[model samples]
Target: MHIVIPIITAVVGIIVGAVIGFLYRKTVAEKEIGSAEQEATRIINDAIKSGETKKREAILEAKDEIHKSRTEAEREIKERRNETQKLERRLIQREEALDKKSDAVEQKAEELDRRLAKVQKTQEESEEVRAKQIAELERISGFSRDEAKEYLVSTIEREAQHDAAVKLREIMQKAKDEADANARELISIAIQRCAADHVAEATVSVVPLPNDEMKGRIIGREGRNIRTLETLTGVDLIIDDTPEAITLSSFDPVRREVARMTLEKLIADGRIHPARIEEMVEKSRKEIEQIMKAEGERATFEVGIHNLHPELVKLLGRLRYRTSYGQNVLKHSIEVAHVAGILAAELGLDPVPARRAGLLHDIGKAVDHEVEGSHVSIGVDLAKRYKENPAIVHAIAAHHGDVEPESIIACLVQAADAISAARPGARRENLENYIKRLEKLEEIANTTTGVASSYAIQAGREIRIIVKPEQVSDDAMVLLSRDIAKHIEDELDYPGQIKINMIRETRVVEYAK
Candidate 1:
């Protein structure tokens, strides 16, 4: 009980100390709150004063900006009103100037109308005066206006014709003096150097049989042997009643020769059978080919031409069987080559190409029966394909006057061909046809205007035309010749070229009594 009393007294003392400590802390917190409230009030009053000053400054800046904008706008408007007043004054001045110009233009237009009327009156008076003068001139002169014009034009035309004729004559005389003699000399020499005999080749070849019985045998049983021979040789075996003779007919001379040889061999063998015929035909074909090859080689050797394509050489061999107007083509080609070479020599040109061209000019004739085209076209193609000289190819194309001759060699070949073909007996034509051709040539020249007379000379190779000096001016002869030549070319198919000889003679005579 004594310990409990001491503990109660100690507890009372602890409670009293706690009450005193709580009161002290509460009094300190109240003082801090009072000071914080005073600081907040001062801060709020300072912020309001600063905000009011900033607002006043912004309002003053805004008012100054508004006043400056209003002043600038009023000044701009005043300047625009002044410019508008100046533009209005300028427009009024322009309008007054235009009115003055329009009055001036109207006065000028009225004056132009009055002048135009006066000019019309003056033109009418001039016309009347011109009419009177023309009438008086017509009365004084014998001719009217149109008649005078016609007469003057005709006189002018005649004078022009005379002058042209004289000038043309002078030019032609000069040209003739320059070139005619040399051309004639060269041609004559070429012709003289190459004189070849023309043998008229028969298209059909004649074969002899031993007897009449041979024909029967060749005909064979049911004609099997004959058919086989024809089929193999591609030739017609005509077993006619011509006294132990058979004719082999084919456009291809090689085939004809083969047929002839086959027939001859079969006759000799005395074995008339299809098999025998075939065998003989084949043998004869190969033999003919060999003969042709030899002939080709011989021709090239004769012409002094080397390095010819083998195919070209073979074609030359074929010319042996070709015939033109009954003239042996091979012989003709050789003649042409000789003539061309001679001409080339005379002209100081290379004769080799001339000769080559001349020889190959008719080469196409060798294959004309097999190919489709004129011999000239075929020859050109062959020459090009064989890689011959371009000059040689051109010569071949132009040899027959199919194209214009461009080179001297081509010209030589042309002249050589003409000389070769124009030889007497070189070709054959019906006598009646010959006479008609000559007559037609003369007729063409005679029918022309101003041609007094015409005569065909040189086997229709030349036509001599005599023109009336009065009707045809000297200069007109050239034109006349060309016209007649053109007509002849268009109307007549001829060999070689025709020469147009013009003759104009003016004779003056005065008798002294």
Candidate 2:
């Protein structure tokens, strides 16, 4: 029994212990669950707080963005409104300006209408006055209105015809005088502007000898050297006592030049032998040919002419040795070219053709000595052979009034040629002959019926006659001038052109105190 009681107690003790352990474990588990629940609630609460903070921040950022967008849109709208206001202001200003302009135009139109009505009334009054005057005129003339009207018309017609005739005479006379004056001025200007030097050339070339002893050397052993030189050069060597000078006389200028050069070289080299003379003569011939070509080129260059044939250029250079009436032909031609160019420019024509024509106008004279034709015909042929412009050819042919001038350029060339030939010191004329020309011009002017006095001016280029105004009527002055010019043309042999001027003036002197 004692052993059973102890064993049972031990079993009860074991069971109670196990129940307490179970209760304790159950309480620990409940506490752990509560802690886990609190932890989970805290995590949930933290997550919700974090989510609320992020949502608020996002809302704030979105609000800021919306506010910024609204501000920008408001600024844009303000700018557009400002622009619209400016446009409206400009439109208003333009409308006001237009309205003012319309009002001004309307005012001007009203004023024009008033003036038109006033002019119409004035015209009506004038018509009434003319009608009354006509009626009175008819009554006084003891005739019907139609008959009186016809008579008045005939009278007025006669008066108008007389007035028209008088006016025509005045206009014609004025035009003639102006033309003469203008021509004189233009010619004077051309002459004044021309500054070319006038060279006087002769058929003889004078060479200076080194010494009187040299002249003996030139005459050489029995004059053989002199004879050889004269034969080769075809010139007359006149070893005269003119102070160390020998004169080479030749009708041909080229021959004279060659002889002059040959003699100069012989004198310079102190070699007067026949062989040296022949060599020098041949050399000088070549030199002269080169010189002629160079001179031709220089002339064309000076005159601004180009594209000329080589043969033509050489011929032009030959004109440098030619003389007409003591005037160097080349110099005269250059002067004529300058004058023609000037005149052509003044007349609004091409100066190139004028200058070319004038330069080549006298080219025929270069070969006229060799050719059996007039200079004009030879010039025409030369220009044609050289393929010159036809107008240039015509100008060359017509420069001397040979063939009637078919073109204005030809006429210009003729006038220029005459001007160059007629300028003072251009040509040689005896003093007696010149004085006689002036006297003849004066006498011709004096022969006119209404001449109170006569004066020949401008080297007989112009003849001025003062006429009595009472004797020579204004209309008669024109007739007198024409008659005087006609008479001079018919009877006088004047060079270049002559002007016949008739002056009819009535002096009305009034003293103003």
Candidate 3:
């Protein structure tokens, strides 16, 4: 039994060993298979991860390409849209401009057609009228159109000439008669109204002394009195040259008048001291002022212009001592006022205003030495300062034509001034200058372009210029007269005025035997 047990145990041992080896082999194989499976799984997983990565990259690239294409398409679409809009705007503007052009062309064509139709109608009417007139002319007077027209024109011209000659003669005769009567009336009225003393020559004012011995008193200790008198009066005192008589030498008439009154007072008082001299001068000045006021009042009353400032009245009175071109200023002003009043009444104007303007027209002469401008300008300023009417100021300024006349009254003032200055004996001129001015007047008239004869009449106050009818027309005669007057005014200086007459005559003579 023992033997059998040992054998079995060995067999079991061998079997166990074989099983162990087989199990070892099986484990090895399992490890190898697991390793192979793990490797394969790793390779497959790696390939899948790489494939997904490639696929994702390809998708991203595709998306990027799609975005680029979309952006390009959008840019191209925007360009196309912009181009389309520009074309539409251009087309719309072109269409509007074309419509305006078409309308303008149509209007022009309509206007042209209307004008052409009117012209055609006018031509047709003119042709019909001309034909009718020609036919009528041919039927009448037994003449062709041109011959009948000539005959009619000649007949009318002859008849007009005969009628014009008769009418001209009658008109001239009537005009002469009327002019003579008016002249006579004006002269008689002017002479009757203005009867002032005729001043032949300027006289030197003399202040007589009470006694010959008073002249020594006037001389003073060292002729201080005479020197003071000369200084004060701006005149020379001839104390030694005459006995009981003194001569006042001054260029200014006003100064001479003042000095004469002062010397007369001093002689009457018999006090020849400087204080007495000054007092006498002051008294004389007051007396002169009073005299001026009285003269001004008289003038104003005469002129029918009463309302005036006391100062203005005194100034007007001073004009009594003033002269212009040897014409008394106050007298001239009065005459001008009268003439202006008459003219204003005739012209339907207010005579009071016109007369006032005329009287104050020469107010500048009172202050002319103190003021710088022309008398007209000075008078205008004075009137304006005194709150005179604007029309009156304008008349004062325009009376001498220094300014443009602003009204009919201003022109009337000028006319009155001229008339007053132009009256005979109203102003005086030296004999030599008078004769020379007359000769110059005749010479100037003869120098006219169409003058055939010239004559200076009425003491050189009027000039008559005869012009050849062929050389001078009726209008030319008027122009020539104006030119002559202007030339005389520019070239000559004389008192009063020179009247210019341009006469043109056309004479037709035929021998009747």
Model 1 alpha-carbon drift over 4 Å, by segment: 1-141, 144-146, 200-204, 430-458, 463-478, 499-513
> Who wins the lDDT comparison?
2
C-alpha RMSD of each candidate structure in angstroms = 8.3, 16.7, 15.4
Give candidate 2's error at residue 140 in angstroms: 26
- With candidate 3 superimposed using the best TM-score fit, by how many Å does residue 176's alpha carbon deviate from the native? 8.8
- Which pairs of residues collide in model 1? 165-475
Residue 166 lDDT in candidate 3: 62
**Better candidate number, 1 or 2, judged by TM-score:** 1
User: lDDT per model, in order?
Assistant: 0.87, 0.89, 0.82
- What TM-score fits each model? 0.66, 0.58, 0.58
lDDT tens digits, residue span 215-294, model 3: 88888989899898888878887765676898887766677788889988888777789989988877887888889889
| Candidate topping TM-score | 1
Model 3: residues >4 Å from true position, as ranges? 1-204, 210-214, 238-244, 431-436, 450-455, 464-486, 489-497, 500-513
Which candidate, 1 or 2, has the higher lDDT?
A: 2
User: Model 1, residue 248: what's the lDDT?
Assistant: 85
Task: Provide the clash count, candidate 3.
Answer: 0
Candidates sorted on TM-score, descending: 1, 2, 3
In candidate 1, position 305 carries an lDDT of 89
